[model samples]
Target chain A: MTIDARADRVTLAAVAAEARVSISTVSKVLNGRADVSEATRERVEGLLGRHGYRRRTSPSSAAPLIELVFHELDTIWAMELIRGVEDVAREASASVVLTESGTRHAPGPEWLEGVLQRRPLGVVLVFSSLPAGVKDQLRSRAIPFAVVDPAGDPDPDVPSVGSANWSGGLAATRHLLELGHRRIAMITGPEDMMCSLARLDGYRSAMSNAGHGVDPTLVRFGDFHVQGGHDIATELLALPADRRPTAIFAGSDLQALGVLEAARRQGLRVPEDLSVVGYDDVAVARWSSPALTTVHQPLRNMAQEAARLVLRAREGASVSTRMDLATSLVVRNSTARLVEPTEA
Target chain B: MTIDARADRVTLAAVAAEARVSISTVSKVLNGRADVSEATRERVEGLLGRHGYRRRTSPSSAAPLIELVFHELDTIWAMELIRGVEDVAREASASVVLTESGTRHAPGPEWLEGVLQRRPLGVVLVFSSLPAGVKDQLRSRAIPFAVVDPAGDPDPDVPSVGSANWSGGLAATRHLLELGHRRIAMITGPEDMMCSLARLDGYRSAMSNAGHGVDPTLVRFGDFHVQGGHDIATELLALPADRRPTAIFAGSDLQALGVLEAARRQGLRVPEDLSVVGYDDVAVARWSSPALTTVHQPLRNMAQEAARLVLRAREGASVSTRMDLATSLVVRNSTARLVEPTEA
Candidate 1:
């Protein structure tokens, strides 16, 4: 076993020479090109593996890297998405670079410039809208991108991943209705967002199906934050006793926490006086006092699927342009049977 | 006033020509160099600002970027750090690139390679250790770096930012003692971390000063996570009623939440049967049940200071090797006056 002085620094060219193949043939084999003969592929692969030869550090051969852009990284919801994407990225030997667009709706010009300079293999955006120019720019560069919970109705050509928001809303509302509650109030996310609209539609549909007309006065819009929920809830709870609702459906767990605070300030007891249902069963939901009953949005799974879809798009593989994972209702201690007014 | 043909695109050369300066002089202004005359500097700056002539897209003149590496991005604590760094980076016209080291102690080889290839202006690491070889590699490249809440005692030469852990721990312990809690338990972070050890030392010192010998059995080491706190708290709470501590001081707010859960499971009333004190007054602390009374470790301020320090170091400015921000105790509803066993 004589060792060549250059043995330590293995190269694709050396592997090609040892395998008695052209550099192109070796490259084809490494890339899983069907043109390479099975015998030739095996020989090249064996030599490459034995010599510890990795793909050359070229633009086309480098390990793929993906970028995840978020409006902000302050919430547990964002953390769940990051975890999901990282899980998929790790399995593919890919890297995830995180950036904040510095705006809620869309990234600014500076962010776009920075992203273009990085030239990532793909991009996954969370709660963001893509401007027409930005879309054209990404297309021009042949960079695949997918959105997780897009801010609005995404272009038909754009790929997106989200949960069944409409179904989640219906399930939550129906649960409250089954517990003998007619005066139910709803708090939804930003009205412009597709998910928010869909969830609101579901709530309306459920109410209609139950033979109860939707009361516009009982419905409020929130920014999907605790403070927003708290402010809106404070307004709702301040209604005269005869007009007050017995149950509230919050748009997010953070908002539901705000509702809880409002109820606490009014000296109202959860489940006993004011039943509550929250969306997005984030980790803290379980730790919340009385343990929130929420709709499980499968945020992590949505992110995982979005990552997979972008990777597939990058590989020129056919994938669905839109994906909606399932959402389910989680019954916890927050909701209980409503008592009659006469009982009080 | 005629618009130039290249008005849409501003160049450094145009700014130099307008200001009657050389290209190198304009470059010095953009890079914040000190050699240029004050009069020349003002004229060039005004022209650059008016024309919006950013530096040319060269390796040396490119926009500044800072890389923030975290062991994991799953915790609210990590989000707080990211928020702080982003706040400073935004003001400095610098972009933040986020990467997970993928290991608890240090980054893997691939992460290091990727970071070096990006050629960032500086680097900020959160709860990560830097190996000697890695440190040397960064130093050789003249890339400045700083750590936030470093895992252990970093090299004296390594710049770092942290909270005053000893004072925070001492204040928390002293508060519990003032409430007449003779038997108190402490839950600190991992044993090897400098911050954890410092906090533990503070607890010991407080106990010694109060003329009570520190009980070795009452101290437990946690991983600075909710589950770790839960498991350790469960064990501590399971002790015979006569032997169990009347109060528990947690190293972090997440741990305090777990302690609350453990007490809840044991049918113990917080601040009545058990008093709890937590560190790191993260946002969630105010939302937790009983609104946790904890020491406020200025995590965001620490991060902001670290970012500022790295930026200064990159400019070839002298800076302190280590910086510690102040921590204070925030009294809330989680703690109360301890009642005697006879009263109970």
Candidate 2:
């Protein structure tokens, strides 16, 4: 139970002594050597974590590769993040090792074994947090890692990069309000994600700051996809003339497109009748007809920062990092000045 | 100079003798060891290519990593290809090594050196062809590779996977013509790319089969980008009412988006005033406001096929392959029957 003294001076001897194993066995586990028995490896790893035994760095341990692991490389944002990491790695004369580690919060133990063997320069994970076992193994092997948490949740002890979700939401709503729209609706992402709550809070603050009370029926929690946007917008547009919002802030670009589809189906002309704003100014935002007026979610820059941070961490710099890059409003063709009276 | 008989039985000793070096030096160069002098490495590589010396496969040489190289990881198609490679590699319990080889058609000597040192299971290049020197280095080291050429051009001797561009074009144009569109404009990709030319030729064939003459003014060679599509579409839309085409078969999804923008700018309603058909049904096609009617270029399947082919080659199978997966049409809101007479 006396953890503080052991945490300060964590050597292989101390870890092996506590685990009741030889130093060579602990070293075998550290190096991810195959001959070590499973039971012995687990016991050594537990002691190493408990003792905070940081692996001493060596020249051969840092290979000329940056590991980029994702739960799922979904849609446009994945490509942007990949490009960002690839750019930084190329600049440092290193290649990228891409991994889709199943649809989960963290990769499995099999992936950990490979990483321990590869001993990459650094790792950039596109997730909010890592499993304790994975984190301990990475630390014991001296592999630095940083998370690119676009979903806005970050573990306090880990280094991470994220976009300013609250600011993005505020800017998106302000853009619509400036267009002379008094009644505005907001569709944020899934309820579980911290990003959704942050965006919703931003929307509420914007409405209250403008001296307007937000109508409960005008707010919705969407799945951050096209179908969700379409479904929610359809219900909103079907409201009575005085109750329907004249403008909508779709939290993501995909949702904005869905809103556009719903508006088209209802024979409502965009900008002319109902203005729309989107977040996550992805490539689709620019390509959509009447290019979206949205918020730019600095995703590529976030990934780039994550890569740089991990690299910096490997160089023995500050690892206690939680940096949120700024997001900005992109005014395109989607929003327009209100020509009709909005007295909702 | 006598490559005929030497091609049948090539060994390190033969290559070393031909290059005027020791067999150990040849072995060092073959293993991508940095100890060999540049002059000796080049000479050994030249002799290896000339004699067609293929290294015998070994267990250690085939690492559990698939190298995926690209010149530029642009907008969206790159992600699809990455997913395909990732899927196949995951099924094979292998990881993917992603490399951005500059904006050139092939990676440089530095990249090739790293690849040789890694000695991966296989390489999947997203290029039309490889340099003779790079190809020789791969073959001499017994590293299997296959190209995923979205461009229609393919190297005759090398294995590659491509979609049926000509067929894609034929399908897109036929779909538009079947909708009672007579004056159909065809905006294909770059004039130099074989895919662009093949697609244009298919359009021509479709027109001829429909008992119509191909109009020179109605066809344009574009850069297969958004700006090119928008610019070309703007010009086409500005033509005299009688000369303007009612339907346009935009060669790629990006171009189709451009076409949509141009139509929007011109205040013309899609499917009502102008019908648009896009090639390469990327995800953007579905997200577009009036989802594009497009040719489904099986880019993901093509990449999967390339990975599978290279993996099979690694297992001592045939490497001489050229595959063109079929392309089909995806009908959406962009194309519709012409309400007015299209006798232009």
Candidate 3:
């Protein structure tokens, strides 16, 4: 069977001939107005590419399809980012192909190589930093890509869209400080990640601004998972009751949930004894047993904006345009008014 | 500017010449390998495709790529299914193209047309019944495809993989009976859907086997959405308190969540006053307040099976084979032991 690239493109006559029913049947197939036999409809479509027939493109494909790559973390966090990506992709009539950047811990060079090979319309890098060589490769390809909360300034040339993490960290810290909790501690993500550093910087800046010296003993780091949060929180709780920090700020919602579980296990009442704040207002944030008062990054909005940026870039926009959306603090039951020292 | 039909078969050398790049650079561009300059990669690819180079028959040509088409439902239901699809697709070193099957209430006849046009290596149709015509079209094109829980027979030629909804429904009803509840009602999905019918059949068979008469009034029609479940439950609650059925079997987890909310508005306590059993056991089911006693469908397994089926189908396997995965009852806090009439 000689592959006739043109034969797949369908013309009215070719469609009619293949359906083996009638010209009107083929017309009806294209128009979808009349009930041509399903058999005939399939046959006509098989000829479409051969005859070079172009069906009116749907709104979903408003822009060319781009692929979004992410490194897997928690189920909830992954879901939230995807939700944001979908919302943006849908409104823009662009489609996103979401793929695991391939490993649970760290995606290897091979993974990056595989993704770049697809020659996607564009690529959205989420929660993962671009390696030095990958950045060089992207620059050389002149591929229009955008970073969605990537680890660091992986590529200054490529635009990025993310929330102001330092501001979010400051807000979380300030909330805890206002509650009269002088002994506050924090749990953060991996050390090398830019997000962790930025969030940690925000915490330090907030503490310093509030006239308190940073206590190195009160800080710890872990992988961004519920167990990581729980383990860190447990270690903190095990500290002498008086030495334990009155408030804890977790870098992620998953970690916050873990903190909550740990607090519960230790029989500590929130607000009355311990207060916690989380980052990323994932859907579960609202539904968790003491609805968490956390930093609300517009994950969906970011995903949408990143998608728009990629599409715009693909349409030949400048590569240097970066979009940084704002983050807000959502107060919920997980936090409480800090009791005065006299009361304590 | 010429549209060349024969140009589709151009070799790498021709593409490089057109792009003014070396053949090695063209190969790197197509392979997504690092070290290539971006400018050279883009120019080479454009020239290759502009000249219509048929992708060479290489390892990359057989690279697994699966297309996922959802039934255009709310995010709540689609989330888990997509996750399941992603999990299996990633394991197989394949990529997923996410698309919707048009509007649920107003699906166009061309729904399948868009999918066929892409010429994806394999297609996974989720919660959709391939109209007889769509199946025939797939068969004639010999495109490898699999339907997830299709409502109709797949032309006796295509493989299908889905959770055992019938068994799931039966388990749900049996659990309610085992709890000593005599008068139980069901809220089912749309009549046209196979899941709805199969689940309802399970309820009927279980009730009959237990020597309980199936009351038509006790069952109400609903879509799988929360509002649909809530609406039906609300109507049932409107009946005199004593006349209301003691428990409700919701056809889906989303529907059950609504049933719980509806019961709460009427000041009813779960399991204590009105026991509820749900289907699908989605992620939310385990987290919802009071948690939910649900029938756990093997969505992940089914997704894996579907992916496997697509692989086989693409390799030209006959359709006589299919897979039906088993499900289990996940008993949780939402259900209670039926109170004795004398005690009440």
Candidate 4:
């Protein structure tokens, strides 16, 4: 894509003239640095109105370079995903920009159009569920892009690269089963997300394959956040002691941490009293109190693949769009063999 | 900026035709996507070579609309920093494009030039330490940008925002001192970095104010990483018992984790035998075993302020420069009072 040379159409002189203030004051107000008086800031803002010196809107050759878009940044899951995207973009000889969709706090479309108009060689969507219309728009514009851990049913046509969530779920559950856990409960991410659904399905299939019926009551839905895990675990704890499951499986590491906290608050010791397992062995998992047992997604590999996908799409590849990588379970101290409950 | 109305530019189709491949495959190669057999990909490369279709390097009316430029995204510090920048940019009514200077891995003028040429309205330097000459180049362009936690004594003229590191360090050290620990040691960040220096200054000043001579041997330098903390702590543990400080202060949360691991490997009980305090109380701090007693920098707040600075700078605010926000200490179980040798 060509750069828009005249992007910086709005000049400081224009803003200063419109604002009726010294250029320095206006600049200070803009920068929010100390030294600008309140009255001057307001006056400058008014002048900005009269002069119509809006920040550059349309992508010009002068506009900033490509941006890396994230659905949410607070979650630990996004950390590795982001690092992966950055690593690949760095190697590809491209500059990286960052933005978040805020699916967790609120859902809306703001950055998508701006990103589309920029005509970046490609974009990386981190663990985001792109709206159907937005996806169609990208397709029509032929904007090369890729999504990591897309949260929905797999669409055979869209190019995506991520780990096998379903298989990861199965691996997590199977590990518990192998250690003699018969009654296993699960905490899953939001229903709309593909990874969450796949993981839940994995849990179910593993139980079924082991000749056991999945208990609907034992499964709880969470928002894939720490608080969600805490809330779900608290709900699980409210059940009578006799009905409590022998093991708990969390969909994400943050959720597993919440589970640990919930168990701790209830005076239950990890592994000794309650066996817990988590997904996404983030850096925190290794140092947590019990050193969580988890399933590790090939984060770096997925990021590299996603970057490659977007770059390829930008280069023009009319091919099937989907990638499902594998996951491996790590045996940590969080899980132990099932022990028969002593009769009170 | 007004949208350039220029139409008839050479499209991907033209390049594909020149390369003698489907338009899709050419798109893939240019965008850097994978899937075409190596032979076809190489052939496409040769075709682009034979036919001088230089991929639209010149500036034109229709500039790429958005860009995402980052200082570096390879480090965990940079990754979180980008997340916040990305989140705010999406909400600020503009699309983003991603770019990086890769300053840590490759610090050169050529790298800086590529980013500036993109001409984004604003750029977010993710925990950047821009070389002196590069800053001048950016200033000459009058490009509006923001830096996060700049490395050394930040220039007062540039508009950047970050948590108050001096206060953060002071708070961390104060907490350890208040816990009745007299002999405290420190593991600091990169020596040249302003934040590291400020933190060290805070640590020293705190001890001096409390009638303690700053022991030079008790202090160590690390690169603000996990292994750095681990290595330093291991070395500290090898010292004679009387020489080893009873309490330790680590510069960053990542490094603190390494220190924790070292303590564990040495069979040192947290609080009972030793105390630790860390800075930049990242999210992981809360869940870490013994829960890191550290200082918290409002990362989200710092990010939001930086975005505001850039937006204001874009609005013709000539008065732009550095910003220093405040920080607080978060007390946890990682630290305890100092006990006499015979007390136990």
True contacts kept of each: 0.28, 0.88, 0.26, 0.43
Give the per-residue lDDT of model 2 (tens digit) for B207-278. Answer: 999999988999999988898999999999999998899999998999999999999888898878999999
CAPRI rating of model 3: incorrect
Span of ten consecutive residues with least summed lDDT in model 4 chain B: B1-10
Clashing pairs in 2: none
| Model 3 collision count | 24
User: Which regions of candidate 1 fall more than 4 Å away from where they truly are?
Assistant: A1-64, A150-152, A178-183, A210-218, A231-246, A264-274, A318-320, A336-344, B1-63, B150-152, B178-184, B208-218, B231-247, B265-274, B337-344
Compare candidates 2 and 4 on DockQ and give the better one.
Answer: 2
Chain A TM-score of candidate 1 vs. true chain A: 0.78
Ranking by lDDT: 2, 1, 3, 4
Ordered list by TM-score, greatest first:
2, 1, 4, 3
- Comparing 3 with 4 on TM-score, the higher-scoring candidate is 4
Deviation of model 3 at B53, angstroms:
24
- What docking grade does candidate 2 earn? medium
Rank candidates, DockQ, best first: 2, 4, 1, 3
* lDDT at A280, model 4: 83
- Chain A alone, model 3, TM-score? 0.72
Q: Residue B127 lDDT in model 3? A: 46
Q: In candidate 1, what are the lDDT values of residues A136-183, reduced to their tens digit?
A: 555544567899973436557779887888999999999999999888
Please state how well chain A of candidate 2 matches the true chain A, as a TM-score: 0.93
Tens-digit lDDT track for model 2 on A10-79? 4778888888888888888887777888999988888888877887675355778999999998756898
For candidate 3, write residues A1-344 as lDDT tens digits.
22332332335566677656676666554443335565665576566545656433223323235677777623565656665666666555445576776553334544444454444556777744566545544443334567777344344555788778888989999999988777889898899788788888999999999999978878888787777888999999999866788899999887887887788667676656789899888766665556689999887788777777877666666655566678899998789987756556
lDDT of 3 by residue, B43-120 (tens): 765665465454423223353567777766345556666666777777777777776544542223343443444455
